[model samples]
Target: MKTISIIPVIRVLSWIVFLGLCIKAGAVLFTFTISLYNPPYAADLYQGLDLSILYSASRLDYIFLMAFAIILSSMQAFIFYFVVSIFEKLNLVRPFSEEIFLLISKISYFSLATGGIGLLAHQFADQLVKNGLVIGKAIDFWEGRDAFLFMGGVVLVIAQIFRRGIDLQVEHDLTV
Candidate 1:
């Protein structure tokens, strides 16, 4: 039986992520433009949608909000890129190689960075609300970040396990 390599799957997923990033960029640009130019039309489009939170936003506020969304999307893209790197390294070399370990560590770091950034963004939004800049509740940027932080820590543990497997492989090789 031939084992299926996961490289192809990962590459496909990376392409999907790239596609999503492009779409998000376009949508953010369009949304910002609409919000700035036609408040009533924009409100009608968002009717019954929670984006009505944006109803009170000024043109500058819309620009700032869109910039925040772009930054968040970029961070998510970095996370996907890190996953692709790990998959590519695993495809080209031993799965237990040090390079894989380093890649996993990078995944952890990037995940942490994303979660931290989300937290900071949420805090900033809160401040904006407090200052009466954003009239309604700000979007919840930090809601799902706990999972990312946890996943980063879990990846570090998995990397350690892979390192131990490397040691076992070395021992088995030495026995020959």
Candidate 2:
């Protein structure tokens, strides 16, 4: 079997991931918006997660926490979107290109930003819980910050490798 055959499968999987993230972000945003007008909705906002205590404790904090969740989800969706783009532009014959390098770098940077934001949100939720809000479940949304950071580092290294490949391809072209 040729590796080229696998590209479509990977692209389809990336699309699935991208769509799932978008749905997650959208669901959270919709729940947050609805909860603003319908406070009772806060009792079960997006899945089994409840933020009623946080809402009852401090509206500002609740809003901020929800904002962070939405941003983190959206950023994750954006990263997968770029991955799909990379797959779309991929050419097995000439895998190294400036565009691919830039896209990979963008994914790395976005992953780093998402990880940072997730960490901040995680800490903020912990503080809120410590301050007397039952936000234990809220932390679930901000989980996996470390994983994103690690993925960012790995992708950055891959991007650098692609950069070198591009340089070598260019040198070979010049010689020919």
TM-score for every candidate vs. truth?
0.66, 0.95
Candidate 1 lDDT by residue in tens digits, 14-115: 878867765655665566567667666444332222334555655555556556655666666777777777766664534577777787778788778777
Give stretches of model 1 more than 4 Å off.
1-7, 22-68, 135-142
Task: Give lDDT tens digits, candidate 2, residues 90-176.
Answer: 988999999999999999999999899999998898888788788757777768899999999999999999999999999999999
Q: Give me the runs in candidate 2 sitting further than 4 Å from their true place.
A: 1-4
User: Model 2 reaches what TM-score against the true structure?
Assistant: 0.95
RMSD of each: 4.6, 1.4
Instruction: Report the C-alpha displacement of residue 63, candidate 2, in angstroms.
Output: 0.4
